[model samples]
Target: MTKSFRNLIWAVLLVTISCSDAPKGETKTASLPVYKDVPYLQDYSIKYNKQGDKLMLSQVFMDRNEVIQVASSEGILRTHDGQFLYPGVLLQDKTYRPLTDKNITAITIYKDQFVYLDDKAVLSNAWAGSLYLKHDLPKANVFAAGNDFEFLISDGPMLQYVSKNKKNWTGVLDKDKVKAIKFNKKNSTFWILGEKSIASFNPKGQTLKTVFQNGNFTSFALLHNKLILTTLDGYLEVDATTGKQIGEKKTKLPWTEITYVDVIDGHLWFGSTKGAFMLKKDGKFDYYYGKRWLPSNNVIHISKGTDGSILILTDAGLGQIVYEEMTLFDKAQYYEKQVRNRHIRLGFNATLVDMDNGNFDTGRLSDSDNDGLWTTMYLAGEVFRYAVTKSEDALQNCREAMDAMERLFSINPVPGFPSRSFERSGYKERLHDPERWQHSDDPEWDWKSTTSSDEAIGHIFAYGAMAELMDNDLKDRAIVLIDTLMSHIVRNDLYMVDFDGKPTTWGRWNPEYVNARPKMVGDRKINASNIIGMLQTAYHFTGKEKYKEKAFDLMDNHGYLDNLMWPMKDVAKAPDDADDWSKMLSESWNHSDDEMYFIGYWGLYKYAFNDTLKTKFKDAIIDHWEIERPEKEGAWNIMTALTGTQEFDLEEAAWYLREHPMDMVSWNIMNSHRKDVTFLEPNFREQTLSEVLPPDERPVQRHNANMFRLDRNYAKDGSEEFSAGDIWLLPYWMGRYLGVISAPEKNN
Candidate 1:
C-alpha cells in the first residue's frame, strides 16, 4: 500500500474511464433486459461450504474461474474445481498492513471498490491486492447510499450525509425526525422509507415534500426512475420524483417479509425466507427455491454476478439463475399442458384445478353453474387448435366438449331449453328445494332448470362457432338446436322460458321489458343488441324467414337500432325510476355486460343477415370498444379486430398474452393491503385503483372478472382451485386464428 502504486492504478483506470462519458468512480452502467422475448429461468449453485463445514458467504468477487469469497468468519479464495486455495489466509498477508478491525459485519462489491464493513469501512481492490480503510465508519443504526453519498439515520430521528470531501457525515437536517434511507444514483435523490411517512432528500441537503403517509414497508429496490417496495402485504411500484404510485404487482407465490430487492438487467429480484424470486421485465415471476432450483428456500441476500445471472446467497448455500426469454409458442404450449393435464374432467371439467404438487388431487377444481359456458371456451380453444394443426387430440377434445354442452338442453324436459347444470340424482339433494330440480325424462339424472341468460349466451356462442367451423354432424346438430331455440323464443314472446313454464330471471327480451329502461341504461342497449344478434344468428344458420323477420321487427318498430348504437358515455340516468334494478343499471358502468356484448358481437358483426345491418353493427362495436380501450382486454381487442377496426391495439393484445400467468390455479392474490397503489376517494361506484391496473392484481380471473374487478380484496366466497372461467385460451386462439399472432416460426 504505497502512494506510487495508488497513482499507477489511478493512471491505468483513466484510460478505461475516459472511454465513456461516466465519471471515474461512477462506472456502474445499467444493462438492458437479459431477455427480449419470453423469459425462462435456470439455476446453478455456489454453495457456501465446499465440504461438510458451512462457510457463511456474505459476498463474492469473481475473476473468470477464480472467486474471492468473504464469509462471516473469514475470507477464502477458491477455484471453480471446488478447491479452497487460500485456506485460513487473509485478504492481505503479513507482508502488507492488514485491517485490524475485528468482526467484519459484511462485505459487498460497491461502486468501483470492494467494501468490507467492520468497526470501520475498508475499500479494497480485489485485483491489485491493495486496500483503503476508513476507520471513522460508525456502527450505524440505519445506513444506505447512492452513487455519490452515504446517508446515516441516527436517534436524533435526524438525517446525516457523508461525501468524498467530508469523510465525516454532517447533519443534513439540523433537527427533524426521519426513518429508513435509500439512495438512487440515477436521479441523485435519497428516499426515506419510514413507519408513518415516506419522504425524499437530495444530496444537496434539501428536503422534499412528503411523498406518502401512514405507510409501512419492509424492503424496496430501485428500477430506473421507479422504486419497488415489498412489505408483509405485497409488492408495489412508485415514482421517486413525483412520489406517485405506479401500480401494485402480484407474485406467483406470495412473498412476505422481504429482506432485500435488487434491480438487475431491468428486473426486480427479491430475497426472503420464502425463497428468491425475480419479477421479470415482461411481468411474469421466476420463483427459485428448494433443491431443484436452489439448495434451499431460505434466501438471505442477492447480488449481481459476472455473467448476468443473479448471485443468490442463502443462509445455507449460494445459487445463480440464468434467464432467457422463450418464443410465444413455448408459452402457449406450457399453458396448454397445464389445462390438458389438470383442468379436465370426464363429465365436467372445472375451469381450474389445484396446482399444489403435494395435494393436487385433494379437493381439486371447482363445480360451476356455468360449467357449460366454461367448457365451451376450452372447446373453442380445441376447435381453433384443430383448425390450425388438424391435431386428432384437439378434434377429440372439441367433440367431447360439444357433447357436454349439447347435454344441457336434452337433460331438461322443456325442448331446446338449456339447464344451467346437471348433476347425479342426489349430489345436491339437500342444498336445493325439490322445486329447483327437473328429471332427465329418465330416473337417473336431474338438472337445475332456472337457467340464466348467461347459459343461453354461452350455448349460442359455442353453437355458432361449431356450426361455422366443424363437420356435417356438428354443423347440423348446431343448426337444429338453433332452430329449436329460436322457435321457442319467438313462440314465447322473445324470452328463454324455463322448465317451470316461466321466463328465466335474466332471459327476458320482450319490448315491454327491454324498452322500459331509460335510453341511458346500457342494459337497454345491451338487451336490444343481444336479442337482435340471436335472431340474426338463427337466420344465418337456418335461412329461416321467421328469425330474420323478428330481427327487423325489433330494430324497426322497437327502435332496437337506436338502442344498440348509442354511445356508452352519453347514457344518462333517468330520475323517474328509483327501483333497485334501474338504480343499479343507471348508477354505474357494468363490466359484466361486457362479456355479453363481446359474445354477441360475433353474430352481430360476422353473421348479420343483411349487409346494411352489418355496417350499422360495425359502428356499434367500434363505439363500445373505443370507451373500453383503457381496460386493454385481449379478447375484446382481438374479437373486434375480426371486424377490421382500424388499429386494434395488437401489441397490447400480445402483451396481455405473454404477461398472463400460465399457472391458472387460483392462488391467493390480495392487493388491498398495498401501500403504493393509489386509492380513489369513495364515489357512487366505489373504485379502488386510481389510474392504471397492474398485471397480477388477482389470480386466475376470466376476462369478465378481470375487467370488472373494482376492489383489491376478492368479494367472492371460498377460494377455488380455478376462477372456474378459463378465458386465456379464447384470446390466444383468436390471435392465432385472426393472424394477428402466428405460431412461432417453425423451428422456434
Candidate 2:
C-alpha cells in the first residue's frame, strides 16, 4: 500500500482510539521530600578600594566577633570596610578606642586580645589586665604570642622574647630569615617559618632549634600534631616535632604559586597569587576566584571569621564566603523576586545589559533575539508553579506573560506570525539587529521579524501546556493561540511566511527545506521533531483534523519519523561535499537545539494522537537524553522525567540545583587553570573535560550553553547580569510540577 493509504488507515485508528477509553500518556507522580533547612553555598563579594578613607588592608584576623584588618605602615588596626560591611564591632566608630598612634610593625592575637609591636613598646587592646612590654626590637617584622604575656618576636635574624615588664630573652636564626611565627599550644612552643627552614623556640628552655632545613619554605601553620608548610609552589604536611616531609610534595593545586596557608577549625585553606581555596574532605578544593569570590584575584591572606565563615583577604579588599541554609524552593522564591523586580520588560523575560562591573542597579532591561522563546520558558515555569501551588501570584505572572506572547502575533501585519520581539517605536538605532526591526501600523510600536523555528516550537509548547494544565480563560486563550498559529502554518504549507511574501530564514519545515539536508545533520532531526510536536499539540488542543493530517503526511510520506528517530550519536559533521549551510549546521552539536527539542517533547509525547506514537516519542526523547547524561543538566534531567522513566539522574538533578550559585551576575569565571579537573581532547561535541565543574565554580550561563565550558571572560569587567527567570526557575518549577521534587517538608 502507498504511504498515503497507510497514513489514512492510521488516522482512522487514531480517531477510534481517541473516541474510546484509550490511555493518554500521563506524567508519573513522585514524592521526593526535600527539607527547608538544607545548607547550600551562597557567595557574594565585598570590594574595597584604597583611594578613599578605606585603609590599605595587608592582614586580616577575626577578633571576637569582628573582622579586623591591620595596615602595618599606617599603624592602623580597625574593622575592614566594604560596600557590604562585615558584621562586627565597628572599630572605625569613635566608641572603640585606638591602641596606639605609632606605626605598627606587626600584630597578633594573645588570649583573644589583639597585640601589636610598635617602635616604642608592645601594646594590646585589652582594657583590663592589659599588656605593655617595653622593647628595643625596633625592627620586629613578625610576632606570635607565647605563655604568660610573653611574645616571640622576629626581625628576620634576631628573635626576642618579650615579657610584660621587659625583653627577657633574645635568639638568632643563624642563616634563615624569619617570615612568620605561630605559637603551638600542643607543644607549648613557638613555631617559626623562615625563608629556608622551619624552627621552634622553647620559651621555657630559651633555646631556638632549626627543626627542618629546606630552601623553599615560605609559610607554615601548626596543626594538631602536624605542621602544614607552604613552598613557593604548593603545600606539604609534616610532623611538628621532626619537621620531616610527611608525603610527596603536594604540587598539584588550583594555583601553584602558593602565597599563604592556614588551618582553622581543622580545615586547610590556602591563599595563592590567583585566588583562595579550601581543601574539602573529598580531596577536592572549593575554588574561589575572580571578583565573584574576591575583590582581587591576588589573595594575600585567608582566615576564619567569627561566624565560621571564611575571610579571603586580597590585594584590593576582603571577600567573605558565607554558607546559608536554604532549600531549592527557597532559591526559587528568591529568583522569583529577582525576575519580577528587574528582569521583566513588557512582560517578556529580558536581560539586564550594560552593567557596570556586575552592579545590578546600573543595568537596564534590554531586548533579545529570543525574547519569545525566553518568555515562553518563563511562562511555562509560572504555569507549572500555578499548577502545583495554586499561587495567585504565579497565576498573575502567567497572565502577564501570556498577554505579552499574545501581542507578538497581533502587533505585526503577518497573520498568526509571532514576532521575535516587540518594542516601543523610535529605538531603531539602539535595538539589536536594527535591520530586522520594522515599524508596525501602530505609531507607538515596532516588531522584530525573521522569527526562527525554535520560537515557534517554544510558543506551541507553552500554549499546549497551559491549555492542558490551566483553567478557565487561560486555558481557552491558550487553545485559541494554538489554533491560530497552527492554522497559519498548515495554510501556508508548513512555513512561517513573512510580510514580504517569503518563508523566514529558519522558519521552514516543508519537505523541500527539511529533507534536503542529510539524515546525519542535526537540523533534519530537530526540525522534524519540532514541527511534528507543534502539529500534535495544535491537533490535540484545537481538535483540528488538518493539523493531524499534515502531521501524519509529514511523518509517513515525507519520512519525518525516520528523520527524527535517527540516533543522537550518529548526528555529526556533515559530509565534506555537502553545501555550506549543511556543513555549517552540522559542524557540532548545537546546545540551543537541545533546548528546543526538550521543550518540544512536552507537546510531542504528552499530546500524542495515539499511545503508540507517544511510546515512540518517549523512546526518541530517552535516546537523546542518554547522550546528554554526562552533562548532569538539571533542566534536561527533570524534563526527562516527563517520560515516566525511573533513572532520570534525580540525584544529579538535585545536585545541579544545589550547586548553582545564588549569584546570577555574569562574573568573569576562570576554571581552565584548575589542576583537579580532567581535561579531554577536542571533539565535535565540544565536551571540554571528562567531568564538568560544579555550576557554582564556572561562569553562570543559561541551559543552552555548554556545561563543560571552562572559562568565560566575555566581558572582562562583567558587564551583564542574566535573569534567573528562564535559567533557574524554569527547571525548578518543572520538577515541582512533574512531582519529581516535593514541596518543602515541615520541620517536626
Candidate 3:
C-alpha cells in the first residue's frame, strides 16, 4: 500500500475508536469527524423483517447455540435460530413452534421460567424444570420474578406471588398507589415504588422498610443492604435498613431523565432520551452515543448477549458492542502512529518537538531541558519496533530523531558537552521560560545549557540501543555519538562538565562525591549505578578495554555494588519543615531517580558481559522492583524484562497497555472526590492514593512523575496529555523485541 493510504487507514482506525481532541462546548473548530461507535464484532447479520411484521425487539436471551429469543414491542414472542416449545414446546430440550397468532401481549423470562398472557386472558407458563401449567390472571398487565418465585399482576396494583415449587400462592402487595416494581433475586425481596414512599417486601409479605419517605426518587436498585435510588437530579444511595440517605450525586439536565436503570452484567445500564451509559461497579461510567458506535442515542432497551457483548436497542436499530480485544502488537501499531502523526514534529535541522495540542500552527511548545531525553525514548522504541517488523517508516523516523539528538552535541562549543536544546535566535513564545537560554557564538541560534545528567543518560541509552539493534548506517552514527559522549565523561574527571566549566546541578558522577553522601541517601546508590552502566554500555558497543577497566575499578575500589543494592526500606525520610533543603531531599522516595534507574538498567542488563556482574546487578534490580511492584507500572516492569528475569509478569505489562485510555488529549482530571478510590491518609510524602491506580484510571501523569500522585487537579490553563510515543511504544515494542508478543498472522 502507498504510505499516505496506510496513514489514512491508521487515522481512520483511531478516530473511529476513540474521541478526538477537538474542542468541546461551542468552540469546536477542528472539523473533526463525528466519533463512530463500531461494533468490535466485525461480523454480524442484519435482518430486515417482513414489511408488516413487528420489527422492534426488546429483550434478548440465549439458549447456548440452539436458539436466540427476542421479545417484540407488541409483547409477542420471537425466536431466530430455531423453534421453541412456547406453544407446548419444551422450555427444556424441545424445539420452539412458530406462533402465527401474533396475539401474545408480553413474554417475560426470569430465572428458569417464561411467562406470557395470551389473548384469551390465559396466563401460560413454560418452565425449564418439570411441571408446566397455566393460571387465570385476567388482563394481567405486568410480569416480574425473583428467586424462582413468580409475580403475576393485574389492574389496581393487585399481585399474585407463586412459590418456586408451583405450589403456594398469595396476594403480596395490593397497594393502589404502586407506580413501579422491581425484584431483587440476590436477597429474595421485592420493592414497590410509590409517589410518596418506597417499600421493600419479603417473600413472606413482611415489610423490610419504607426506605425513602422523605425525598423524591424516580428509580432504585437494591445493592446489598443499600438502596441506590435515582432522584430527579442524580443518584442517591440510602441505607436500605434505616431508610436514611447516605450519599447523593447531583448532575445536570439530560442525565436527570434516566428512565431505565438496571444492573446488568455487573454494570448499571441506564437509558434516557439523552443517551445510554453503563456505570461500572466501581462507579466509572462509559457513555455510548449515536455518533460513536450506536444507531441512536435514544435508548429503548439495554441487554446482554451470549458471548458477553452488550446488546443495545435504540430508536433507529439494534446495536451490539463486541469486545475489541486487540492483540498487543495491533495496539502498538495504533499507538506508534498516534505519536508520529500527532505528538512528534520534525523541522529545521531535524529538530523534533512535542506539541501540547498535537498541532503545530496554533499549539504552543518550548525547548525543554530534557528534550533529548524524551526524543531518545521515542527513538529507542522505533529501533526496537524496526528490529521486530523491519518496517521502513520506523527506520526513517529514527533517522530523523537521531538527527535531532545528534545536534545537541554539536550546537554548543563545550567539547562533547550536549546542550539541553537550541532554537532559532528570536522565536521565543509567551509561555517560554527564559532563564537558562543564551546566544551561541554563531548568533543565528540560541541554546539552553547547564544541562543535567538526564540528557546524557538519554543520549547514551538511545545510541547504545541503536548500536545493538540496527544493522544500517544508523548503527555507525550511533557508535560515533556514544564514543564522543563517553570520552567527554571519562576525561572530565568522571563528571558531566557543563559549558560554564562547572558540573551542572545534577551532573556529578565522581566517586568521591557519591561516596560522601549519607548511607541512606538515594543519590549515593543511584549515581554509582548510572556511571557504571554508562561505562559498561560504552565498552560493549566500542570494544574498548579502557571503558571495561573503569567499570571494574569503580566496583572493586568504591563498593559500587553494595551501594547500588542498598535496601530501599532502610532509606531515610525527611520531616515536614518550612525550609531545610538538606533534610528535604531525603524525605520520601525520589521517583525521578526511578526513571534514571530504569534507563540505566538498559545498559546494565542488556550488555552485561560479566555473568557475575549481571547477577549482582540483577539482585539490586529485584530489590528495587519489589518495592515498586505495588505501583503496577508497565514501563518499569517491561524494562526489567531485559534482565531475562524469570516470571517477569509479561502479561501484566500488556494488560496495562490494553487498559490505558485511548483519549490522549490532556485534560485536568480530578478524582479526589471519587467514591470508588481508596485514598491514603495525608502525609508529607506525595503518593496520595493507598495504591497506584492503572494508567487510565489515575489522573494525568507523565512516565517519570510519581505514579501515586493523588492529583493532576492542577490549573488546566494548558497541560499536555500523554503521547503514545514514550507511554505506549516503550512497553509494546519492548514486548515485541523480547518475544513476549508476536505479530499477528494475516487472515486469508
Give a tens-digit lDDT track for model 3, residues 135-161: 455544444555654553433245544
- Candidate with maximal TM-score: 2
Model 1 clash pairs are 38-325, 38-326, 39-325, 40-324
Give Cα distance to truth, residue 361, candidate 2, Å: 2.4
Q: Which ten contiguous residues of candidate 3 have the minimum total lDDT?
A: 82-91
RMSD of each: 14.3, 8.7, 14.6
Q: Write the per-residue lDDT of candidate 1 for residues 55-75, one digit (tens) a residue.
A: 554444443332444444454
Question: Lowest-lDDT window of 10 residues in candidate 2?
Answer: 10-19
User: Of models 1 and 2, which has the larger TM-score?
Assistant: 2
TM-score for each model: 0.64, 0.91, 0.64
Error of 1 at 4 (Å): 45
lDDT of 2: 0.79
Top model number, lDDT = 2
2 or 3, which is superior by lDDT? 2
Please say which candidate is ahead in lDDT: 1 or 2. Answer: 2
